[model samples]
Target: MRSYLIIGMCVIFLIQYFLKLQWLEYTVVTLSLLAFLGSTLKADKFPRWLGIIMMTAGLLIEWNKDTGIEGISEGIFLILPLLSLITLSPLLSIPLRLGGYFNSISVLLRNLLLHPKKLYAGISGTLFLLTPILNLGSVRIINEFLEELKLPSALSAKGYIVGFATAVMWSPYFASVSLVLLYLNIPYKDYIIYGIGFSLLSLVIGNVLFAIWEKRHPLTKEAGVKVPLEKQHQKQLVKLVFFVILLIGSCLVIEHITNWSMIVIVCLVSIIIPLIFGIVSKRWYELIPRLVDFRDRTVSMLNNEIMLFMSAGMLAFAMKGTAAANGVSDFLTTLAHQSVLLFAIAVMVIVLCITYIGIHQIAAVGALAMQLNAVELGISNISLALLLLLTWSISTALSPFSGLNLMVSRIAGVSGVQTGLRYNGLHLFIIAVIGIGVISVIG
Candidate 1:
C-alpha cells in the first residue's frame, strides 16, 4: 500500500512536470496529503487540527489564480526542512547532549558575573555551534546551558531561539544547500567549499554586529527556569553515530561514482537504507515500528501544509509551460549589462528579500538561476553558478524565515519574528559587502 502511494505520488509529480495540468497537479498534492495522513493514522500519531490547518491553507492557496503546481512544488520543497525538524527528535538527541554541557557552564558563569551581553552571546554562540551537529541539538544545548548558568530561562531561551536564524549561515551539512545544488545542476563539492567561506563570513560579521547592537540597546532581564534533560541511552548514541557515519560515507562514495543529484543520494540514505537495514535486523519488529513512527510523525507535522503550498507551483507551471519566471532575470540582466558587480549586488538583494518573505533559499536561488540562463547572459556556467552560490549563501544564512532559521529558533525557544528583526539587517549588510568583493575576485 505504501509502495503504491509512493509510486502514485511520483507519477503525479512527473506528470505535472511534463504535462503541466493544474487540476491534475492539485490532485497530485491532494493524494500525496492523503497518503501522508493515512500513514500517520496507521501510526496513531495523526494531529487532526494541524492537518485541518494544512488543508485550509492549501485550499486558500489553490484558490488564488497565481497558485499552481510549480508554486506548490516550491512550497513542498521549502517545508521539507520544517518537516525534518518535526522528525528530528530521534536524530538530534546526541548532539544536543554534547552541546548542552557547554551551554550550562556558559549560562552559570555569565549570570554570576552579571554580564548580560556576554551571557547572551555565549549562550547564543554555543547553540549556533550545536545546530549543525544534529536536528534539535541547538535547543537541547541552550535549555541546559540556561539552567546550568542560573540565568533567566526566558532570556536564555529567547537568545537561543534568535540564534537559529543565524546558524544556517555557517552549517554546510544543511539540507538547503544540498537541495539548491541539486536543482541548479551544480556540484555539491563546489557549494560545500564555497559555502564554508560564506558561512564563516556571515557568522563572524553577524555576531559582531549583533554584539554591537546589544551594547547600544539593553533589554530587561528575567529570572531563570530549569527543565529536565531528555536522557539518551548509551546504546542509542552508538547506533546513531554509526548510522550518520554510514550515511556520510555513502554520500561521498556516490559523489565520486555518479553525477546524480545530492537530494537523491540523501533520500537514499535518510529514508531507504534505514528501511532496508531495519527490515534485515533480527530486531525488525522494534526497529521497523520505530522508523515508521518517526516517518509518520514527521509527515504529520510537515507534509500537509507543504503539499498545499506546492499546489501553487503546479498552477504556475500549468499556466506557462516552457517560459520560466523571467521578470527577475530580465531585470537582473539589464542591470548586469550595465555592470556585473551591480548585477551580483542586485541578485543578492532580491534573494535576501525573497528569503525574508518566507520563500525557501533553494527555490529563490534556483528559480533565479533558471531565469538567468548563462547562455543568455553571455557568462560561463561556472561564473553564473558561483554567483548563484554566493546569493544562496547570503539569503539562506541571513533570512529569519528560512528553514534553518526556524529550526534554530524552535530549538532556542524564540519566535521567528524576534530573530529576524534582531539579526536580518546586519547580516544583509555584511553579506552584501563580502559578496561584492568575492564576486570581483572570482570574476
Candidate 2:
C-alpha cells in the first residue's frame, strides 16, 4: 500500500511536470482534500478540530479565488495537502539528525564555548574563510554546548535550532541561493564569497548580543543529564556520517543537473538512498504496514490550523498562475526606488511579513525570487540571492510554525512558540547586520 501510494504520488508529480496538465491540478487538489477530510474523520489521536479548520480554510481559499469546481478538478486542492506532507515528512528527519550529530561533539565543542568571546570571534573569522562550512559547524557546536551544559532545554534547543538560520545567511552552497544563481547564470563562487562576508558579521554580532542578553537575564540553570555515552553512540555516528555525505552529494548532483529542481532531487534521494542502505529493510511487503503506521501517526499529530495557512499558499499559487497576483510583484517593485538599499530592505520586509503569517521560508523565498526576477530590477543577482537567503534563514530560524522548530521543540520537550520567540531577536539582529553587509558589497 505504501509503495503504491508513493508510486502514485510520483506518477502524479511526473504528469504535472511533463504533461503540463493544468487541469490535473484540480484532481490533485480534490484528492488531497478528500485525503485530509477522510484522515481527519477516521483519526482519533490528532486535533480533529484543527483538521476541520484546515479543510475549511482550503475550501475558503478555493472559493476566494473563485477556483470553483474546475479548480478542485484541476488538482489545485491537493497542493496544500501535498505541500503539507512534504514539509512534515520524516524525510526531513535526515537533515535534522545530521545537524544534531555535528552538534554532539562534546569535548571539542565545550572547549570553544568556554570562551564565548573567542568562539564568536572564531566563527566570525571563519565565516569568510570557510563560508561553505561554518554555518552547519557553528550550529553543531552550539547544540553540543547546550546539550552538554544542561542549560534550560528551551534555550538550548533555540540555540541549536537557530544555527540553521545562521548557516543559510550567506552560504552560496545553500540550495535556495544555488537555485537563484543557476537561474541567473551567475558564478557560484562570487556569490558564495559575498555571502560569507555577510554571514560572518551576522554570526559574531548575533551571538554577542544574545550572550549579553542572557547574562543579564540568566535562565534557570538546568540539571545536567547523563550523556548516552555508550549505547547508541556508534549508531548515531554512522547515521550522521551518512547524512553528511548524502547532503553534500545531493548538492553536487543538483549542481551538475540544473534542469531538475532541488525538491525533486531531494525526494528521490530520500526514498532511494534509504532503501539501498537497508535502513528501511525489505520484506518489501512490510512497507505497506509502515506507511499505514506513518499515515496514522501523522494524522494523529495533525494541527488543522496548518491547513488554513497552506490553503493561502494554494490561493497565492493559483492566483500567480492565473495572473491575479501579478499586481503583488508590481506593487513590490513600485515601493522601491531602484536604490539597492531600498530594494534590499523591501525584500527583507516582504519576506518577514510573509513568514510572520505562517508561510514556510522555502516557498516564500522561491516566490520572492520569481517575482524579483520578473521585474528586471537593477539589483545584482548575487545581491538578490543574498537577501532571499537571509530572509529564508531568519524566517525559518524564528518561526515556531516551521517544521525544524517543531521538531527541535519536540525533541527538547519544550514549546515551539517559546523556542521561536526566545531566538527571534537574535536571528533578526544577525540577518540585519550580515544581510545588509552582503547586499552592500555585492550591489
The Cα local distance difference test for each model comes to: 0.51, 0.52
* lDDT by residue for model 1 (38-59), tens: 5444432223343344344454
Model 1 residue-pair collision total: 27
Q: How big is the RMSD of model 2?
A: 7.1
Clashes of each: 27, 18
Model 2 agreement with the true structure over 91-171: per-residue lDDT tens digits: 333333333453444433344454444444433333323223333334444444545454456345544554455556544
Instruction: Provide the lowest-lDDT 10-residue window in model 2.
Output: 126-135
Best by TM-score: 2
Question: Model 1, residue 125: what's the lDDT?
Answer: 56
